[model samples]
Target chain A: MAEKIKPPRIRVSRRIKKNKVFKVKVKFDHPSFTGLAMADDTTEPVFNRAKPVTFIRNMLVYYGDELVSRLSLSSGIADDPLFTFKLKATKEAPVKIVFIDNFGKRWEASKEIKFKG
Target chain B: MVGGLTIPLLSVIPSSNDAHGAVFQTPKDLENLTELERIHLPKISLPPVVEDGASASIVCSVDHPMDEDHYIKSIQIMNFADPIVIKGKFFLTPVNGEAYLSTQIRLSGGEGTVWVIAECNKHGKWAASKKVTVAAGGC
Candidate 1:
């Protein structure tokens, strides 16, 4: 019989963009294991232990091969973490975001928009 | 011989006395009464408050004609958005007849002003000094 390996989960979503400001949120729920332990005389207790987890969130903006801006956020939580900042982008350039989680997990995403003529 | 000596003595001395009596004009006898009066008068001038990226200097003068030593009380720097950045206390040194201070500040923000307050420590009493303001730059 083969054992199953559990993978860490991360959810990244775009929140809002208005007046040249961009905001994004990232969230993660750490994996945990439950075990039984003997305590006192005849009583047993259930112990829940969490695995080690660390994550870093970063947003990178590029114009051609040149990197223009970068913002990074790191946290440990079950809910989403958001970051908001302003960027001056024209129709010719696009912005990219990269989120790296613990256990060597990596996620890459990009967004492109045309300027109003 | 006796007659000539007595005549010479009488001629040298005034008989009843002149119109004005003997006037003493010695350097040691002269007293600084007017100068003493000026020393007790209070004369305190406040310094201008300096904003961030600006330079400010303050000069305080005292009329100590007798060169008496005194202390300054409650020197404060106010109107600072963040007081942690500007360093130093309010006490000053007695130099010449005055105390001079030159403080240069580099603030974090580009706007807002500050006021520098000073007071004289007269024993347990305090004499208030003038307030100076440093204006901020326009955005």
Candidate 2:
């Protein structure tokens, strides 16, 4: 089933030095469930067993056209996880992140790189 | 006759490296991890104590060069007690200013240790761990 997914919140450090590394922070709204939590013990079949696993499986980070980082995630991550990583902006470009979930859903967000003097 | 088969056989054989082009690898066993050089070890920073079942902030980084030829490949957070030992793994590139990551992880009930493993393309793997005490009840 298709569902609406809000774009991820992305924030890039302002006033970055030329050719210097800067920080990028991203937050996603996701359950990130490990599928280990049981919905109910009294039910004939546990509620969790019937439900499919839902979590972000892969993440890719890009600075402009160049691929910067890739991540393989698991259920160990908490709900609505926040991630912070470093990136060096050689040229002015958008820093984009794409996340793929177990259900084959893709969500992405980007922010323009603003350089400082 | 033998020469005719040679061409087909050579093409059928797959290359040793991955065809899909995976730049980094996850060490599954201790032997594979031991084979890597112990340089550029990761430094882990987190509170020494926390409330039970509370989310703890974790910051890890490696002081290494991010050159095209050599750089930190990935950073992994692990806990032996968790259902999945690897909490998360982040693969990196030269564009990343440095090998640094800041995130949060929830520790299981009770006190235990958490480990951070860093992998470098040229240098093998380096690891560091910290003990976190989870207070049973604070409310």
Candidate 3:
């Protein structure tokens, strides 16, 4: 069974204008473990094999049905990683973000891109 | 006697400082790299100048296919003068918007060259460097 994953949170700027660039921020509540660090219980820094390496393997951003951006991630990203990027909002549509962890858990969220008239 | 001798010693040491203005600089002799390796080199974008304490938005990408068998493994952002040169590393895949990343980095040194190095799983490392300076503190 896939691990329990939290829903991804997406935020689009409110003061966006048509044909203008706007910011989109997405945050995921997940642990990105490299599984190379020592366990907290260990006295010395040693590779901990008890836990498996897991991270957000893939992140996709979509404007309505069209794929606008995609980010393939690794354990290099920290836990609860927050990413910010820009998109030119040409129309009012839902900006969706989907994240798939290395363990195959899928999480997603969306926010409407309402441009300022 | 001491002052005169020191002057000659200083002059004998080559000035390693860059004389050119703020600009992104990369190795000129890229012909040595295989055509495929040259294609994997990172293309970095950033402002030439920024406020002393402001963050500089950086975008790096490579014009290469991210195939499963041969893809860009990671993009590393490094500061030439930072005690810890490696700022961050982003691993990518075919789904990663054409192996692109947009983020901001503070040139804590106030003025210096920042580098973005991209590594392909099969092609090794390709790097690009950009120089940024604080307002009024031109490099």
Candidate 4:
């Protein structure tokens, strides 16, 4: 990214609760520019085949080794996208979230937490 | 005139609604199969009214067993008004652990309908829809 942003932060609430549905919160600092506009318009040198892949198009969230949820996004999504979801609190598990932009670049993060029974 | 029998020209041409390659635009009168209805369910989740040129969300969640044995096969979305149907597909397995899906879509101004169909890997298919109204001169 041209502009540096803070790293993404993730938290799972009621981390130690058993049999309770887990709530996940994720936030990242970044500009999600859209590639659609730049895909067609190339008037300026800055956009010279810049390959407008500015916005994220796919997101995958996994609990443990299993894929639990995924989001298929587009330019319509806001910048620094925030997402929340629920997974039946199984035993202590590891979580991984991955984001992919239109240009085929991928960003991913993983977290490990403990659950109390 | 292969055997002196005149072949009707109309019979040789495929009907406009029966275009084979079209994934959308299913004809309402075809009687051979319910394949179209199978792909696009009978009912779906949609907002009663949506503003013009606004982003709309279509929910394809159906209450089904999400255990290792039973789960939704996949979710398919389509809109009859737009040319590109078969918008996207979300494949599901027990690993997903959730029985729901939501897809964000944009309408091309005015009234439009979006369809959702969820196929159960073990059970069958389910369908739903949403009706939208856009503001004047909006999409």
The most accurate candidate by TM-score is: 2
Each model's TM-score for chain A is 0.46, 0.83, 0.85, 0.73
Greater DockQ among 1 and 2 belongs to 2
Going through the candidates in order, their DockQ values are: 0.01, 0.30, 0.07, 0.06
RMSD of 4: 14.7
Off by over 4 Å in 3: A1-4, A38-50, B1-126, B129-139
* lDDT string, candidate 3, B11-41, tens digits: 1111122324434223445546456645676
CAPRI-style quality class for the chain A–B interface of candidate 3: incorrect
Task: Using lDDT as the measure, name the better of candidate 2 and candidate 4.
Answer: 2
Poorest lDDT segment (10 consecutive residues) of candidate 3 chain B: B1-10
The better candidate by DockQ, 1 or 4, is: 4
Q: Pick the candidate with the highest lDDT.
A: 2
Model 1 ranges off by over 4 Å: A1-50, A57-59, A76-78, B1-139
Model 1 interface CAPRI class: incorrect
CA error at residue A54 for candidate 4, angstroms: 5.0
Per DockQ, the best of the predicted structures is 2
Candidate 2 local lDDT, residue B60: 79
Model 1 lDDT tens row, B33-118: 24432332223332333352232332222333212356433233333443222222333322112322222222222343333333
Candidate 1: Cα lDDT at B61: 27
Ranking by lDDT: 2, 3, 4, 1
Top-down TM-score ranking:
2, 4, 3, 1
iRMSD per prediction, in order: 33.4, 14.2, 14.3, 16.4
Q: How big is the positional error of residue B129 in model 1, measured in Å on the Cα after superposition? A: 34
Report the lDDT of model 1 for residue A100. 46
Clashes, model 4: 9
